[model samples]
Target chain A: MLLLSACGAREVVVQGNFPKPLMDPLPLTLGVIYTDEFAQHEIFDEAAGRAESDWLVKTGDAQVEFWNTLLNGMFQEVVQIKDSQTLEAYKNTVDAVIIPAVADLQYTIPLHTNIKIYEIWMKYRFKMVSLEDVHGNENGDLSIKPDQYFADWTLTAYGKTPTAFLQSDEEAVNLAAVVALRDAGANFATSFSRVPDIAAWMAEGLQPPPAEATDIQRLEND
Target chain B: MIRVIQGKLIAGLVLAMSILQGCVNATVDEMTFLEPTEGIGDASVVIIGRRHAPDYETEFDFIECIGDHIRRGDNSISVLHELDFINMMYPWFEPRTAPLRTDDIEKLLSQERVANRFEELKLEYMIWIDGSTIETNSSGSMTCGVGPGGAGCFGFGTWGNAADYEATIWDFTDEIEVGRISANTSGQSYMPAVVVPIPIIAPVQGTACDSLGDQLLKYLSAKM
Candidate 1:
């Protein structure tokens, strides 16, 4: 049993620190929902051939940590809700809610490619919903429901590293995963306001504060 | 007698080192667009690798080697590490969002945050390095076999390695490309085995790094 377990699969827990984006914050209280699957996401792949080994990659913790830091930097205020029920309780306090999920993930190894590189590709789905009318219950507690979604969009990211730099396959995969995550964060930070739906939503009342509004010192300290 | 023995040891060590090192041929080409009028002063600079290419990513160790060489060569210049500067600027220097041209840098600087950080670092120049060391050619092979009495190997193997790198210096203070330097190096490595394999490896990448680094230091330190 021990020998079998040893040969079963190679496991890699993605680990890396993500930097906060340098940008002016939007003036809005944002609510974020992290579903269980998204928070504990993992990928298991079976060996495709004799030259390959089964892989188990866990990137959930890094994803959660990265998004948390990025969103905090992108917005004036960010609230993390426990679940859907909790989101209802905080809906009145926030302008809108965003739910992020991992839509798909794929990877390639040097053994599979002619170039000595390891690559990882990730896709993310974001659902942005607006709050409906706020109502007070008998206890004076505010209740609100999620209304029409302001935006539902998908984002794709890619990362690759050369085998010459890394000594082991696990390390290469971990680095590639981190690179892809950073890429996704960069793409989202730079293109978020450009999304048509997001643009229209922000156009209603919120215009990103001018360049002077950004806190450069604070970002540098972070 | 003791002095003679120490001298002999030192001479033997030098001979061994020379024997172990393979032959390397290096060529460097440099062009300066804007000459510096004054010393670098208290201003700092960053050397970052370009990883936007689809086929290859510049080796981080090579970039570090160049930075180390420059720092060791000059004491007045401040060299910010590649990873630190990239992280300090965050998304702006990322592989996907990094500026591709000098004009793009102007656009990036227009962003107050990026410009603020650039000023905070006292950054005067940015060196964007791109290229990689590759195994260009290989010939011969080695076969090893073990016997019950003892293990022995007999064969020969040789491979050719080449490193091609280019460094583009961008003067952030002037918001223009100052100059470009390129280093090309190649060498042949050999491994011969009688009972045990003896490998004489070529320092192709190291040669390129040293050649490029020396030229960069001269350019940065030049006052005319």
Candidate 2:
């Protein structure tokens, strides 16, 4: 009877809040870049081996894809640059570059208990380097240095049976990854619209292009 | 002996109470607003999640339920779900350590891209939702193991769940906080036979959503 009383399921509470965008999001052309090696950001456990099965190795790809899907329409433009060469090609086209890496991903099922605790996290680095920084000025003089910005976000999820914990270890791990990546993508998408420094940079780059003669004439006619 | 009978009776009563507690429903602890709510007749308002919290299952369902209830009160007010809102304004603002201040709202309006959309949508208000439903406490346990045929769980247990939510209303036209509504609810569930877990608690999330939605409409009513 005493054991029965103690065996009650532990409360499963997954709590967090996503903030509303303070102001309208800035209209800036953004690029997402992934290095050759880091592109496959698979998670590993303490045993120095892959945390999940072979199927889960591509989880990192999903995160990057999610970021693009979210940011594509929200900003003026979002470009996906998979390698350094492509990043170089788009130097003049994009206003900023974002590199997201999976910082941590692990799922552990304790030896003594059926409960499984899974965790997933992502880290993002941002750099705003103008075309002038790389190609030099009209006079072929490299006058301005690249302005750099870095932001790191991590999300952890816990699953203990009867509520938070799911039925299988795989399921729990997948759930954690999905939740963590969702937040990471959300944070990355809105970073420039909220962060003071980044927002300023975005605003500076967001000056409206000179109106065309036809556009002006149409407006005047209206 | 009579004494023995009394001891059993007391134990039975305690068990009955514990089990019955799970069936109680949830309710709104308190909801408050500052300035009088303006009539939002025919304006489109959206309910969105806070950009910083961890999301769980049924998150959208929770928000949708509230939206449905709010719409039920005033059919004219178009309530946009979180997904629709996000689609309209993707790449939301960054996660804030704290809620946005007046200055933040101004900055947002300064962006032509965002401002134009708000104008196009005729968005009048935004309700920011933050909170979750979690298991708070539990007693008893169940054991499960895999056999040759399949895996199964055995044993009996009971647990408690608490649903807490806070909704803050932001008036876009005025660019100020109209009011704040919060719901803190508690409930419980029982597993008479380890396999089936039955929920019995007061003020469940459904109740909270409905109550909040109605209260919000009432507060926003021109009649109020």
Query: Which docking category, incorrect, acceptable, medium or high, applies to candidate 2?
Result: incorrect
Model 1 lDDT tens row, B33-78: 7755576889998999999999988999999999999898887889
* TM agreement with the true structure for every prediction: 0.87, 0.58
DockQ of each: 0.65, 0.15
Candidate 1: residue B197 Cα off by (Å) = 1.6
Residue range with the least summed lDDT across 10 consecutive positions in model 2 chain A: A213-222
Best by lDDT: 1
Q: Candidate 1, after superposition: displacement of residue B157 in Å?
A: 1.0
Question: In DockQ terms, which candidate is top?
Answer: 1
lDDT of 2: 0.56
Q: lDDT of each model, Cα atoms only?
A: 0.83, 0.56
